[model samples]
Target chain A: MNAELPRRAWLRQNAAAVAGLVFGGAATAATRRAASPHRLVWQIDPKKCVQCGRCMTNCVLVPSAVKCVHNFDQCGYCRLCFGYFDPGATELTTAAENQMCPTGAIRRRFIEPPYYEYSIVEDLCTGCGKCVKGCTTFGNGSLQLQILHHRCVQCNECAIARRCPAQAIHRVPVEHAYRMKSQAASVTATWRHKEDGPAHA
Target chain B: MPKRSRIWAWSWTLVVAASVLVASGVQRFPKPDFRSGYTVPQYTPPAVERTAAREWLDVGLLTGGLVLAGYFALARRSRRGLWILSVASLVWFGLVRKGCVCPVGSIQNVVLGLVSPADGIPWTVAGIFLLPLVAALVVGRVFCAGVCPLGAIQDLVIFRWRPLPLWLRQFLGMIPPTYLAFAVANVAVGAGFWICRYDPFVGLFRRSGPAGLIALGWILLLIGTVVPRPYCRFLCPYGVLLGWCSQLSRRHLTISPDQCIQCRLCEESCPFDAIRVPTPPHPDRAAARRRMVYALVLAPAWVVLGAVAGWAAADPLAAKVHPDCALAAELRTEESTGKKEQSWETRVFRASGRPLEQAEEADRDARRRLRRAWAWAGAWVGGVFAVRRIALGRRSELADYVPDRGQCLSCGRCFAYCPREYVRLGELDGIRGQP
Candidate 1:
């Protein structure tokens, strides 16, 4: 009986060792397979974006990956820019009521009479797309929402992309990092012409 | 009173008075009017840019820390080295890194990766998640000894070494598995990482987060000072996995480098109560057999009860996990009441131009998934409890005191207390020539 007990114990120990080896090997293999270098990162396309405010709330991160990127060339430097002032604004001023951005991300500076230059405060921009919607709707889409690559942790599957109404977000090559709108030369030219009309007429 | 004590008392008083003065000075000037002509300055906060290089550097640091931990715990057998390493890890991983992409929270990422392969995981994240477990398999939980920032922070504050009753310890021990299951279920159902969301230390590491989370972090730190790694031992879902790996570790840290001399000197040395005392031979084999059989019979019953309870609570839990379900419900109530006012989420949904039925269907789908997940979670918890009960009931005789395999953190605290270890290190001369 004593001999049988030792034999049973030894058998049990060996069996456990074998089980551990098998499971550990399988786990290692699975992890290696799952961790492939050929992985796609999620990105937002500025042109396709609808600016539905989902990017801010739907992102897994507290601060969303999306941020407003300004194309200085595309901006017409208009005093009454639709992106900065609310559509229903009583006056073209930097009042809280007149601001289109909920977080006051857009900063306006007076350049000359009837002309103002606007810059985006990236920190305050919640990537809510409120200002982007305003810009796209009534003005040249100069202020567009793009995935700030530096802020993006680059999740394999973006939470916001899944919820995007426009389905604007898609995987892009790391080399072709950002999907920026081409400088809206036509829109800028037209806006400049409209401003010139008041001066010359 | 001692001179030092008096000096300390005076210093504290001065500090408190200074703080009070500062606080009073900062009181809000009662706004003269609701809309004052105060134009807020337009300034940009410094942007913290995350680069691929930085992520790789973090991974490299993690790997180096693990290697150092293994060496200190297993080869060097130096408790001081472990302490130094712990402090370094606390600074680098906790304060410097702000506790993101941590191994503790990486479990969710690994799960998400496996279940939803379409949403791939970063290589660094996978490495961070698996490296510690692999290390545990080879050399026990060296990660817990000094590499884990969470454990390091708690280890530093541990002043009291009081041991809880075995029954209480066993009961509380079940919480980690439950937490693990809950976190997995939340992730599986597409709810954001709840573990990372509620990490007690992250807020402190960042120096700022939600006020409620910061308060919770402070409270946990206070408890940790007395309880000795209350979070790691009782609540860390990741620790449960590490414990399992450590159990099957090929080579683990031993209290004595040579052999235990049965001196009983190291009994009260471990603050975490990871030491196991020798057990006498069983007197009644028949009673033990009967108890084992009884546990086996009752296991299924326990599982069923747990499942039923989970199913009953599924509705509330489901509402919490389903992203838009709760909001949609609230929107329904508002609509019924003829209220035009709507929350941002509801307004966004309305503006999306998607059919209301689609939103309702999505909510229903999420609820159904959550219900299934909760049921599984409950069963998992119940099974864990049953297994723990069964394991506790089974016992074998031991000749000497030894570190409990599952609970031992390889912290090297017990190593110093073991006289045999001192003899091995050549610090103490043995009466007989060393073997």
Candidate 2:
């Protein structure tokens, strides 16, 4: 009987911790279930990215976390992209030495006439805002940082709020975030090449 | 003087081995542009290469080996062996591998947190980083003890001795798992590795970056006051994970009863409390039985309860028992005045792609199924347990074999390898401030 009182007293004193642990266990389980069918919370709107370079510069991480992604259809395949080359290139060429953005985030691929492919090496991106600035000012506003939704912290209020010009940034529901740009109708019409078709949705 | 000699000797040996491997690997493996970063370059098509050395290095093989070795030595009371193995792992993993094989990819977490996207976290890279860590846990800090380049580096530099109390150590140990769960969950939800953002060693090793190096330098310098390698003990979730692994280590470091001379030197020596009182002569049979019963009861209960509760929790109208879930958040956001907003899981049950009617009548069938599943599972598990105790009235013979992957992260192994865990400081004192 005496032991019962001590045990009850001990339980009462540690009630909060016990409750916290129980609650924590349930929360852990819920988090696991929620994680199973992963969703894209942040999205990149290909239409708005000016490639202003703000993503590289204004990001909180040391090696600016903003990595450039590609939209194969919209690219001009111009001998040069302000996104790739510096202020001015001596000539349109694929020389390793004469590129623009410092970290070589862009990779060029050849695919028939007037449509060479360009890709971003995400790990190499420093989010320096240089590419964004160049692309927005000189080329199609294609190379923008759309938060990758996967890499973003989803801060209640975004940390980059103060620096974002154009005011283009806004949160959307997670389900609708990654609305892939529709396939270019012309490409869809031509069934000559299976490889040249629209990307997976 | 004795420690410094060990450090010097190990450093030289590591340099030679690293140089040979790099040379051989360079010859055998394809080389990506090493100078690609430095040269003022635009978009260049860098060539890709396939090399076995690069593959293993990238996967953190050396670090894993070194950590395992260092912990083995520590557990066995060979200080010289501990220092050598620890140093080798850190140098190879950090300096040669170029910071790629890291579980600390916070970028993924950041993205998840920002967008709250519905895609599962990418496990490919995470799996690679965790493999060696898991191995270390199973075999003891074999990773931190000998292979983790970071722990190895810190192991070489530690110079002092002050012991922390057990209660405080346990308290601090508790913090990393929470951090790990949060980091992993956030990453799964699209947030990048959040913990890596504040990693102090990255700055220190790079030699010079931002002024944060000054703060890091002071942390290293404080080794003079307390025992050396403080971070492994108090921080480093990776180490905690390994310590748990060490408990079940297959190829473990064991004391040779004859070689020991019964000096009890190793007991005093272990900074991590790893050299526990030689497992009591005979295990406490009563306590063991009780623990076995508890685990036997709890394991099946968790699986059964988990499924049922998972179903119940999915109902939007149900009261939230799990905090911090995205589903729970959705439920909280629903602005129903009186009539309950139906659960997301419940909504999922309706004809696919069809929207739910706000009225409960539409959900009648779905609600019945949900309740039935929950009740049936719970009742079935409960009945089994009751029957087991009543029919057998005896203890379970088999031991529980739960994997440490989810719950027991591998950080403790790293802590065990570091000699600095012995240090007992009240709080981070007037440490040098960073600009």
Superposed on the true interface residues, model 1 gives a C-alpha RMSD in angstroms of: 15.5
Extract clashing residue pairs from model 1.
Answer: none
Give the 10-residue window scoring lowest on summed lDDT in candidate 1 chain B. B25-34
Q: What is the lDDT of residue B276 in candidate 2?
A: 37
**Tens-digit lDDT string for candidate 2 (B1-435):** 699999999999987885564333222122223332322123322222213345555555644454555454534445456566556545654654434335443223323423332322333333444555445434545555555555555666656565567666556655554445444443442223445644556545544233654386457647624554556655565654455444434444443311222334345444444443323333567876675577667666655774565356435532222212333344334534333436533233232343434324433444444444444544443443444343233332322111122222222333322222232122222221110
Docking class of 2: incorrect
**What is the C-alpha lDDT profile of model 1 across B99-125, one tens digit per residue?**
777889888877765555433456777
DockQ of each: 0.05, 0.06
TM-score of each: 0.77, 0.44
Off by over 4 Å in 1: A1-67, A73-76, A86-115, A121-137, A144-201, B1-53, B432-435
